[model samples]
Target: MLWRSPRREDAYEIHELVRQCPPLDLNSVYNYLLLGEHFSDSCLVAERAGSIEGYVSAYIPPLTPEVLFIWQVAVRESARGAGLGGRLLQRLLARPAMGRIRYVETTVGPDNAPSRAMFLRLAGHLGAPVHESLLFDRSLFGPDAHDDERLMRLGPF
Candidate 1:
């Protein structure tokens, strides 16, 4: 498999692959594509035999100059375990535009071991710090309702 930057032409295949992943809101794919274009970030695709098998999107915000946020990464079920995800990450990290980046960050659900493991391994390889914390959202009921709104915060890188 080969990883390359995504073209506008690859939107359909990227959307289809993202749709197959659970916990993803398929309705927002169009907006996601727009975000990538607007930010000049990398939206990369992994292709095999002329078909897109996976993709990863990453952005380095000007406000947070030294940090790269890996927004999303997904691989087709048939393409899993092929190291496509790692390759896509490596390509994103190697981008000239990101040369000044000192940290890479991402958030994963606490129970999502595979996603967490992926980020951990990447963090280790890059020798960056990974801080895991409980992410809480405001709730209608009260502050004690934090349990229902908790997620994980795995960075500032």
Candidate 2:
């Protein structure tokens, strides 16, 4: 698989990848287009034979320039279990523009064990400190509620 930054043409493909990863909030394709075009420097996409197979959308938050907030990571079902998601993240953080970033931040549902484990493994591989704290409560989403999202940070890398 090829790991590289995303492109506008990959937006629709990325959106479909996200949809196949059940339970992930499917953002608008236009939003994905902007992400691919505007934040390509920080995001990553995995492809094989010209077809998109995985994506990880992230950006360095303005308020905390040292932190790269990973907004979303989706891997094609057929590509799962070979660590594609983690590879996507590792490559994204390896981008030259992200060299100054000292930390990674993302929120995950407490029950999402796969994601939770992935970050833990990343922290171990990066040899960074990993900390967790409450990020959002159910009330924050009003009625169409989801579980609390806990903030996970791995950093000073």
Q: Whole-model Cα lDDT per candidate?
A: 0.69, 0.87
What is the Cα-based TM-score of model 2? 0.96
Best by lDDT: 2
In the predicted model 1, the residue pairs found to clash are none
lDDT of 1 by residue, 9-101 (tens): 677777888899754436466765575577545677878899988888777766987878777788888877766677788778887887777
Q: Across residues 81-121, which tens digit of lDDT does each residue of candidate 2 receive?
A: 88888988888887789878899999988788888888888
In lDDT terms, how accurate is model 2?
0.87
Give candidate 1's whole-model lDDT.
Answer: 0.69
RMSD of each: 4.0, 1.0
